[model samples]
Target: MSGIVIVGAGECGVRAAFALREHGYKGSVALLSEEMHLPYERPPLSKQCLPAHKPIRPKADYQQAGIELCLRTRIEALDLAGHRLLGRDGSSRIYDKLLLATGARARLFPGMEGAATLRTFDDACRIFERLRAGARLAIIGGGFIGLELAAAARAMDVQVTVIEAASRLMARGVPAEIAAIVEARHRAEGVDLRLGMQVAALVAGGVEIADGSTVAADIVVAGTGATPNTELAEKAGLAVGNGIMVDSRFRTSAPDVFAAGDCCSMPYRGDWLRLESWRVAQEQGAHAAAAMLGAVGEWTTVPWFWSDQYDLGLQVAGWAAAEAKTTIRHLSDDAAVAFQHDDEGRLICAAGVGRGNRVAKDIRLAEMLILREARPPADQLADPTFNLKSLLKAA
Candidate 1:
């Protein structure tokens, strides 16, 4: 009998597989993965002080759920019209409904094919093996992955240098005010920061800067961001843009096929957004599973993500534009939350940073406020004593 099939076997795919059962579909569920290992958590790869691999769920869980877990399976082509997936091993899997949660791959630096990138558990193991104390490591990019790696390496007593083409760290989404605090923490931890510097090439022993100076390193890692794994979707003649395009329900251009997580882009607040957050992947997986089960509703989960560097914890909810009006709430000397409001005074985004989950409660509340379209007063947001929970009730 044909059943539901999910591709990729990352957080999204695994979550959707379980969600399908939770939502009472009760049909056969099969999860296919290109990797040989069990579906593992990808976030801890960059932050763990020691080499560790954590599976999303144990092997017994899938067996108990009667979900067919197939690893080292690669789908070469998609026969969308036939509702079939052509495998690389001369096999085929027919599905009543298919989910493409293929996730994303790391963007490598030009001519740096040999440089290490932390995307998979195997990749993390290789990097960790080389991260001995006093070893010099140079990371290309100042984004979350790079910074998190720097922090982890520092904890291991490894020397770290972060190289960024942009003028500031996390230039893509994080605000400058919060970025400055992160920069300060990294500096205090003895990380050598090279901002606004272009990489000329990957030299024999280090990275060559645009100015002809080579940053010496025993190990080089590229945290240059990720690109969606949408080749299969594109080949199947589905709508493709920055990622596989889907509607509110995650339905692809073709029938009986859907997508979610980093592999797909959906409409958000007037434009299409492709988010790479772990929380987004999990939430979208459940949402898409319900969609596959004939549920109809808009995917309105707010875009949220968090990062850890040393003792600092940073979280951001919703989309913060550069021109949005901002208000700051000082939680402590080293902790603060920034709220961004649109012209109509509606809460659009919120960001917070503090020591060890200090700002987690506030950021979570701000996320709820954004979802409710709350136009909380600026003074209330700025005042530390004003309980954010009250704002949620008012909304």
Candidate 2:
């Protein structure tokens, strides 16, 4: 039947399917997944110890919602002109409206095809199985994925050696001040951190560094980053840049076709931003579903993300540009929050690192302030005794 078809079954695709029903759309909805198993949560794969694969929604839930869930279905061709999806098995599906939520694939290092990369539940399972106590684990790339896995490996008594090409961890978005706290915590947990080192290639025992040195390891994993899965969209002749280009309303260049999540890049404040966060995927999916059903609005939610390593929790809201003016608020010993404001003193971004969600409340309030464009005084933001909620009230 020709109806709404979501071309992926990740968080964005699954959320879009349910959101269509929730928004009172009395139409057929089909969620297609190339995976053999049901849609599962991916965030916990690196955080929890041998975490049980938790499905985003039980099977019965989809049946009750009248959403057809297709597993092991790979769409090989997209006939955008004809509005049809061609499957590998000579099967075809017609859709009146389509959502491309293919997500992204792990970026692999050249000549290291055997090295593990965590993108699927099966990948996580294999990595965890190999991470036994006393095993020497070598992780290349000190980004969020590599660092989080390092923390998990250390907790299991495994020796982890993190090799980062950059001078510090999480250099992409996190400020150096916050990255220092994360680095200190990792070191305290007995993690061997090798900074400012470029990986030459994979050697017999472990990885070879550019300095003609090698780190011995039982297993090697690459956590460089991810490349968006834009092959299907590109083959279909969609405008593809860093990702599938979409507007603020999640509308692609083609009519009746939408994309969201890591697979798509939408416009922000005078720029195009493609975020790879769980919250963004969830929010974008719901917002795109509403937009598909004639909702007239733009997806202007403030970008935010969080990470957990050992006992420390880090949360960041908005873009914390390195060149932006920063104000610090001391929460406690070894814990503090940083706020970035523009030249006009408008709150642009906030980042906080503390023990176990201690910075969550303030960071959330800061997100609201950013959304409201509240320009509280720098002195007020720097004072820990000053409640951030008061700024919201005053605004």
Model 1 ranges with Cα > 4 A deviation:
none
Per-residue lDDT of 59-174 in model 2, one digit per residue for the tens?
99999999999999999999999999999999999999999999999998775677789989999999999888999999998988899999999989999999999998888868
By summed lDDT, the worst window of 10 consecutive residues in model 1 runs over: 107-116
Clashing residue pairs in candidate 2 (N, C-alpha, C atoms within 3 angstroms): none
Candidate 1: the clashing residue pairs are none
As a TM-score, model 1 comes out at: 0.98
Best by lDDT: 1
CA-lDDT, candidates in order: 0.93, 0.91
